[model samples]
Target: MGKGDKKSKRGKIINGTYGTRRKRKIKRKPSIEEKINVEKKK
Candidate 1:
């Protein structure tokens, strides 16, 4: 196999794994109960 082919294969694997990790880091908006609880704490 050529060096270029090896690099492309590694790049594909890295890209696929990185995408799922990125999605997991995304924050969802708080629910109404969560918002109220936060205000109560303050």
Candidate 2:
């Protein structure tokens, strides 16, 4: 294949321009008692 064709194929994977979409989620922190116990150990 030509150099331009090779570049286009690489761009598809690296750019992720056609990937699936999913909801973003983050983990919640521990409670107050959990925090206090961790601090006490130190």
Candidate 1 minimal-lDDT segment of 10 residues: 1-10
Model 1: per-residue Cα lDDT over 1-42, one tens digit each: 233332454454555543432344568899999999999999
After the best TM-score superposition of candidate 2, give how far the Cα of residue 39 lies from its true spot, in angstroms. Answer: 0.9
Top candidate when judged by lDDT against the true structure: 1
For candidate 2, write residues 1-42 as lDDT tens digits.
333332454454455443233223559899999999999999
Identify the runs in model 1 with alpha carbons over 4 angstroms from their true place.
Answer: 1-26
Instruction: Give the lDDT of residue 42 in candidate 2.
Output: 100
TM-score of each: 0.38, 0.38
Q: What's the CA error at residue 12 for candidate 2, in Å?
A: 15
Segments of candidate 2 deviating more than 4 angstroms? 1-21
Each prediction's Cα RMSD? 5.8, 7.4
